[model samples]
Target chain A: MLHSVALKTLHDQRRSLVGWVVAVVLLVLMYAAIWPSIRDQPSMSDFLDQMPEAFRSLFATAGADMSTPVGYIQIELMSFMGPTLLILYAVGQGSSAVAGEEDRHTLDLLLGSPVSRARVVLEKAGAMVLGTLGLAVATGAALVLVGRLFDLSLPAGRTAAAMLHLALLGLVFGALALAVGAATGSPGRSRGVAAAVAVLAYLVNGLGGLVDWLRPFQRLSPFYQYAAHDPLRAGVSWPAVVVAVLTVAVLVAAAVWGFGRRDVRG
Target chain B: MSSAPVERDDAIRAEAVIETHGLSKSFGHAVALRDLDLTLARGEVFGYLGPNGAGKTTTLRLLMGLLRPTRGSARVCGYDVWHESTSVRRHVGFLPGEPALYPTLTGLQHVDYLSHLRGADPYPRALVLAERLDLDLDTPSRDLSKGNRQKLAVVLALMPQTRVLVLDEPTSGLDPLAQQELHTLMREHVDGGGTVLLSSHVLGEVQRVADRVGLLRKGRLVAVDRLDALRARSLHHVHATFDAPVPVAAFAGIDGVRELSVVDHTLTCAAPEASLDRIVKALGQFPLRDLTCTEAELEETFLAYYGRGEDDAA
Candidate 1:
């Protein structure tokens, strides 16, 4: 397990982890606080209804009632802002795990010990999972707190389920970044590749519903499984959860294999 | 060559701790290390001397299992470096030329973390080494000076108490006093039956502690022999200024003098140690005003090996 490496890596990232958690919590609270004002405006629903269907679907806000607390939270937090923040945090942490060590010329020192290469990669991936999970839990707690204070009557179980899905979604990108880092000992290239994948996947999922040719390929996108089911309203989808977990597992395995085979650059 | 006995007999009797057979490494089309054959006995401090980019670092990295060799093989403690790297690493302690530490970690934290990874208790040894090197354990590594960071790296590499120590340019950033202290520590380590493979471009540092040295040039092993023997064969450049003009033929018949030249009142030539007495006697007959003899630098000695071809190498 290389417990010491994972623990030390987590310890090193504590400051950045705390900063990200605070940002996610504050963003969730601010959006939840304004939900009452939007619900109070009666004509806001008519305004949203009159808007173009293509525009609403493009943002993954279609079939969501803006006046309701759950609908507003899904669009503002879970669908867009929350995932964006978590993905950024996850990708940054994952890419830096291996490639950053090489960049700083510290990988040789670590590998000089008796630890196996596979253990090092696996332990770093474990640290990334723990960090993203912390962010997700903090975001869920902040939503629950704001919901009670504002009397939005948010469902606690469903919100927790949404946070779990969000965390898994972040894990997929984190593992992808880690895989890229292991393949090439370049942090900038790893981050660029993972970020590009995320952006392209999001676009395909967003525009899939309107374009006929893209609709068939939407299921291939992780974002489609992430937002298409609306876990906040209908609870967790087992198939989607399976796909997310499988993606994380496959990417992490690839990272370990790639790292074990390559030469460690000094 | 001097026939004085080497100080340690245990080193001669000990089994080979490190051995390489036709070891070669190339990056793309550029060869970093050529087909090299070498061996180091247990409890011996073997100095690896070479110029920059002369395959010193490449050889160390190959032994550490950080880079795979393109041909042949290297072994540590009788285990192949690439096939049984974990076992090799368990027995070896290494200090890289450029030591990189975690910026957020303090020196003490780094020690603890690395110690934990090695699955050993190094706290006691670490504290003692830190004091010897005059390093602040509480300072963040990023905030420490280069010499301090080097001190920290030395502490980490030495604290593990492994069987073999591979140090590459270990004294690079250390002050003179600290370097002296490190030399004392290395001698003690070898005395206590630990094998050391030290690679450095600094010739004097290696000459002080090494029992024998292997000279490398252009990725090839040019020479390997006892330090005293190599020193005996080294040539010195002699420049003598006389009160009157002297004939170049006066130095021609000296036992080990060569390339003798006379320009006006000055005479210059290369002389080996064995011919020093004859040359001094010959110079005394003339009116000598000023005389200076400079011992050949390590680089010059290395060039001398090439000048005479591989047959003349000890």
Candidate 2:
């Protein structure tokens, strides 16, 4: 039954998926076609090093080897692109699942069926999970092709782990959006709030990376927990994985509880 | 003051349906329901009648477990709305006054999504209902007109084989033909032993199908009676066209008879039930060519019950 709902969500959002796919293709081409020629440029890190440490830390991983092919991918794409795109897609998709129902006046119709509020919450979450997975898979495939073409001997598992981290982080963002949607009565307000939360997550995590005192505060932003540098250079951090899993579960549970208590009269 | 209690009056009972007792609700200062009592029998076609703000929609919302009542309580299909909301939701089918559907979704996709939420296959019944209602499956709900949106709401409401149906203004945007089709489906469902609590403004439609009617005004139930009883309590006017004019004096002595008149070889009189037979017997000797009797029906009686009178303001 849940699979059916997920499929329906996909079909309903096919237009959005198409747009994202086109954007992803263009992004992959830029990394594959444009970035490779500049990998050997000695002046790249010299130019980046001139920027303030705070700004530099926010954009690229510290100690990253910009002279190599795989390191260049990390510096150019995974540092900024991974979290930003996932955050955008997660907020846009997840907030609408519930709030969009209110906007369309279909909440009454859905509630009137033999459907429980909890089940609705679960189905919407399932759709977001699948969507996040699909995105990770697409990005992983693009990275694989680019890695081979550039003759970069990067291990497949590391990039795979980074994509997994991206997807899991997207799931967490999606859950936060779902909770916002459930609490606010108005869809437009919920979307606005969700977007603001996403931006805050990015800003805190980004700024915390460069500043000495703010480094401790970065844990508050989900983006800090999902930094691909550790997983991309070393391996998946089980502790970070645990945090992501726990936070996603907690947010989704709160969303279900809130939905259960309130009146869905639309 | 006592009359024979109607033998066929069976108290409604439902094993898995929504029920409310003395349910009352208010928004800030506006009272929505006041000590309202109702019983929806299993598989019974119950018609709810009320003017605007008469608490009909509020009652349905409570049954759907959508809103918490300020006072009193409701149960759905033997499930407590407060304690067993999930169970209550699983058995009840509801249609709101103006259904707001997802504009981006096609009719098929919307049904599928809702069905998925219910943990069931959503499209088969949706397909059948669309066919029955003559709705195009390809059109997005946003593009559908108001009437078409209403039709989609109907499809959603009736597609589920729920034990209880709580429909508010179910026919507002329907054309006459669709209305008739809906009536037929409702009657068929009731005949198959499914229950319905239909709220509507059309009196004639209610009269044609309602076993009993509850009159609500300003969030209070002023009258509850069987349709026939309401009509019977009011005065009836009889118009009899005879072969020849009968003398008015012939019916003057009858009790509870008034306005006896004979003109153009026809006789007419206004009387209650007791005097009706006597008046007819008095003119038995005359050849009766045409007789047309008109009763003060439930509609007029209902209007008069709520009619504004001089004393009402005072």
Candidate 3:
């Protein structure tokens, strides 16, 4: 706890991280338990096909081949639930990094020392990145390990690639929240803005296939950089990774700039 | 032995460790601090006295770089306050008005974190301060009493042992004994060549430790004087009961006489220590049957400059 800012931040979130890891494991376990029955029924694929085109596109990024492990995992985990959990976790951590400290009035204690404002923001961003990536890796490992019990042998390399994209996706939103919180010094406002932007970005990605006008802008959403290339089926997209990483870098820089130029609230 | 006088002369002529040149701050239309010009030498405690919302906190924040100044500039240990705030903060140990700690962190953890940020070892001096303040270092901040939390904050601010300490209402929540200990610590810090600028609403608290005092009223520094000089200028109550009635005009004409009242055979008035001789000579003109003179407390001295109006500030 007395170490550098990044280490201290991770230390502070240790208990919450454990809880999140447990939740991710349980969620994967539930999906694994249901997979065998769905694979044997064959009618589950028909049910997915019968759904409205918009609903079908919203839920499934790849083709709705529920019989195969990769397609099922893509439809069930990659498109929505996985991103939602990771993004929520990232956004929460980022928003709380600066504004939450100020809200608790402990910022004076930390800032009173010789630590520069920019360093605090940058180190907190480093913590968010590490935590988000660690959670993504856990989610991926859980998916592959639990899927084995249900005869769903997903490729380890493809799963790692997908998790990589997912982690970067989470980082984008996390950095946005961090920037907002640093600029405004209000945790609630920061969370609200980040959530709103995420919802808008999510809608653009989910409805992009059905809505013609939303098609071009879909590529602009962080979700597009995450799942549009179908990292689960076609492992790793360098362009998407570069874009997401660049987005996170710019946002973190903005956070530092925003925090540096303003009066910190007590 | 002869070098002692040379060092004393140099100390007298030493550049002020804390200097603010016409520093000012305002939030929109509301002025928090205006045209503050102050200087503090090493080995001195300068008490900042003001009611709430008189820009005491704002001034401290500006000095800390938490809030940038709107006009002019300030320097702590020769570093610019706004542009070079990190440097200024390197030398200044600040205790905020309401010192909030991490609720889950224990006192020792808080000290460790702060000292580590300053890149100093944690235990030696912190343990000493904790023992002196009677604080339980193992207790989490949320569990600590208000005074205990204050004690922990005090330890953090003083542990670094920086060149300057800017404390905002440092003794607000302390018990009398702890307050005394804090005052003693401030004196010791100043004696060790550290400058202190402490703010307080209670004149008695400042009077105990400050060599010089600055009074703030409505965003302006109205008075700055040596504590001894201020005390010398402090008003004294003079009450005389003569056998014959004294003329109201006799004492009314005296310098520094305020609130003068001469009714019937009794004359009661407040006059500065300097005006005591003239007031007494006026009383001597008539045979005085009874005479009583007592020095008023500095609280009254503060009130004389600042009326009893809380609504005017804050």
Listed per prediction, chain B TM-scores read 0.86, 0.76, 0.89
| Model 3 per-residue lDDT at B241 | 95
Looking at model 1 chain B, report the run of 10 residues with the lowest lDDT sum.
B1-10
lDDT of 2 at A94: 75
- The sequence of per-residue lDDT tens digits that candidate 3 reaches over residues B1-314 is 01111123333434798889999999888988999999988899999998898888998998999997889899888778888887678788999999998888898888777776766657478899999999899999999999999999999898877879999999989999999999999999998888999999888999999999988888888778889988888989888899988789878889999889889999888888999988888888999999999889886776675545734554
Q: Model 1: per-residue lDDT, tens digit, A1-266?
A: 12388997898789988898788777877787888898899787777678787767755455667778888787677767887888898899889999988898999889888788888899899999999999898888989987778767678898888888888888899899999998788999889998999988888888898889998988888888787888888789889999999999999999998887777888
For every model shown, what is its TM-score relative to the native structure? 0.91, 0.80, 0.95
Question: Tens-digit lDDT track for model 3 on A1-266?
Answer: 66677887898888899999999989988888888887898998999889998887778885878898888888888888999999999999999999988888888988887788998999999999999999999999999998898788899999999999999998899999999999999999989999999999989988987799999998999999998888988889999999999999999999999999888765
Real A-B contacts recovered, model 3: 0.73
- Candidate 3 chain A minimal-lDDT segment of 10 residues: A1-10
- Pairs of residues at least 3 apart in sequence or in different chains that clash in candidate 3: none
TM-score of chain A of 3: 0.98
TM-score winner: 3
- Span of ten consecutive residues with least summed lDDT in model 2 chain A: A1-10
Interface RMSD of 1: 1.9
Q: What is the DockQ of candidate 3?
A: 0.77
Candidate 3 regions with alpha-carbon error over 4 angstroms:
B1-14, B302-314
